[model samples]
Target: MTAVVQAEGLTKYYGRRRGLEDLTLDIQPGEIFGYLGPNGAGKTTTIRLLLDVIRPTRGRVQVLGGDPRDPAVRARIGYLPGELALEGHERARDYLRFLGRVRGGVPASRIEELAERFEADLSVQMGKLSKGNKQKVGLIQAFMHEPEFLILDEPTGGLDPLVQHEFLAMLREVRRSGRTVLMSSHVLAEVESVSDRVGIVRGGRLVAVENVAALREKAVRRMELHFDAPVPAADFEGLAGVRDVRVEGAGVRCTIDGRPDALIKAAARHTVVHMVSAEPDLEEIFLTYYSDEEQHSARQESA
Candidate 1:
């Protein structure tokens, strides 16, 4: 499949500080690429560079096989900023209509359909709308055009769980239509559900890019299994990608690093009553990369 977005050695700076450095990646067409990182980690910077909102200090970026500065290339892309700036007094419907018109006139019916689906009160002025309502407006505009490539920065911010699910469903729909989505978010679980592949960024650089299933596997999760009969400790001992195995009476417990199949099949050998698996939270995942980046940064600073 052709790449919808490709960046190589993409670098940016703000004064003496780095914004994004040596960033390189390819987002396949019709794929949802999750850009995972904490705040000030250059997620926004990368988006801005892609949109041509700012210039890259170095390297190259191609959107839709053309320069991002090309208006035609930009027309095929949709974007929502991390910080949404909407003025008050203008009704939400009017606000969205204006954006739609600027983007070549989205159908009136389409606009109304999205408004109702998101439960947004378009009659209210943008300024009077609650934070969630304002977000709904943003979503409507970003998605109304149905661009080929979507770059959403914290797209579901300020929205409730239901609204967030709605937004993700919309994203999934976009991908279903064979469009591409690049979602930049720190919300790991949400992204995990929708992303085909996730790129973990830290300190203005891409650290790891792996398929969701693969990444989750790399991050070992603890699992406890209870069986009717005692499991042969030897059956699971030192199994490939299995670690920290312990036997306690009729139960067996272990942490599977990158493969659970082996452990599962072994457990199935016994009469299994129940099993519990707990994946690490974002904080735990964050510290894993953050600390590594911190050490790398420190070494670079010293050098």
Candidate 2:
């Protein structure tokens, strides 16, 4: 299948500084791709490059099967910028309607439906809306047209927890319709549940890309097991990906990294009355890639 977004050796420079470097990637169709990174880690720069707002120094890029500068391709894309600027005294509803017209017209009911989902009051003037409300307006415009591809940056910012939840659910529905999304955010929890695969970018370089299910296998999870009777620490120790074992009376606590098969089998040897497996530290997993990359880069420079 043809990729929705493809880039080879994608690089961007700002004067003497590097905004992005030697990056190559592909975003598949019918999937939510989470671009994971810290601030200034080239996430926004990559987005801008794809949008053709800033030209790359050297590289090949294709968006929606054609150049991003193609008018037809641009017409098929929906974007919500990281720093959405809403100015003027225009009513939020009016602003969205104008954009809808610019997009060749979107249904009035669609606009209202998005507003209600995000609990946005469209009657208020754009200038008077708070940051969160402005973001809601931005989101509404991005989704109101139902473009073929959606590129969102920090979409959950300034959104309340409930609204964030609603936004994520909406993303799933978008994917369900066989569309594509490239969502960039530092908040892992916000996208973890919806993202099909994630690309880790650090310091302007693409570190790694993995399916969310595969990432789960590699994540560090705090695990605890309760047995009806006491178990031996030796039973859990020395198991692959199992460490920090502490078996006290009927309680067993340990840390598991990567696959938990070893630990699970060990616990199965005993009568596990109860078990508690905390959510994996996905952010830490991403950071490990950053750390390894920095170390390797440093070593290469020294060599």
Candidate 3:
């Protein structure tokens, strides 16, 4: 299938400062591609380049199989910037109406529906809306058109838990309809919950891109088993992928890398009464890419 979004050697520089470097990636249709990074890590820069909000200092990008500068391509994308600027006296409804007219008419009903889902008060002036409310309005505008691709930057920022859940549900609906999403966020839980694949960016460079399942496979899990009887340490000592093994009385403890198939089979040798496993948090997995050495290693591996 043709890529919904593609970038080759994509780099951006601001004077002597780096924005992004050598970012080559492809986002497939109907996939939620989570762009993960901290502040100043170039997530916003990448989004801007994709949208043609700013021209790249080098390399090229294609959005929806065409140049993002093309009006037709731009029309097919819905974007919400990280730092939304709603400095105006116009009511929320009025602002949306004006945007709808410019976008060649988004139905009023659609706008109203999105507003209701986000619990945004359309009657409130744009300048008067609280931070969370402003974010709601931003979300409404982005989803109101129901574009083919959504570029959302820190989409769930300032949202209450319930609304965040609602927004995630909406994203699922978007994917169900065969739409694509490029969601950039530093929040790990949100991305982990919804993204099919994630690209980790650090120091203005792409470190790694992995399927969510693939990432989980790399996670280290700590497991403890309480057996009905003392199991011989010899059983688990040499098992593949099991590390840091400790045997005490009728208990066995170890960290398992990837699948616990070998460990499980080994433990079944004895009567297992109970088991406790602690999965590594996604944040812990993400931090592995942030180290300079690890980033270099990842880039080399990818190459």
What local lDDT score does residue 238 receive in model 1, on the 0 to 100 scale? 75
Per-residue lDDT of 1-303 in model 2, one digit per residue for the tens? 889999999999998799999999999889899998889999999999999899999898999999998877888899999999998899999999999998899989999999999999999989899999999999999999999899999999999989988898899899989999999998777778889999888889888998998889878899999999988877877898888889899899989878889888888999989999998877777777778888999999999
Return whichever of 1 and 2 wins on TM-score.
Answer: 2
Error of 1 at 64 (Å): 1.3
Poorest 10 consecutive residues by lDDT, candidate 2: 281-290
* Per-residue accuracy of model 3 over 1-303 as CA lDDT, tens digit each: 789989999999999899999989999999999999888999999999999999999999999999999999999899998999997889999999989888889999999999889888999999899999999999998988889999999999999998998999999999999999999998788798899999988889988898998888878999999998887888889899999999998999999899999999988879999999897677887776667557677799999
Model 1 agreement with the true structure over 69-105: per-residue lDDT tens digits: 9998888888888888887798888888888888888
Model 1 CA deviation exceeding 4 Å by range: 280-286, 297-303
Better of 1 and 3 by TM-score: 3
State the TM-score for model 1.
Answer: 0.91
Ranking by TM-score: 3, 2, 1
Ranking by lDDT: 3, 2, 1
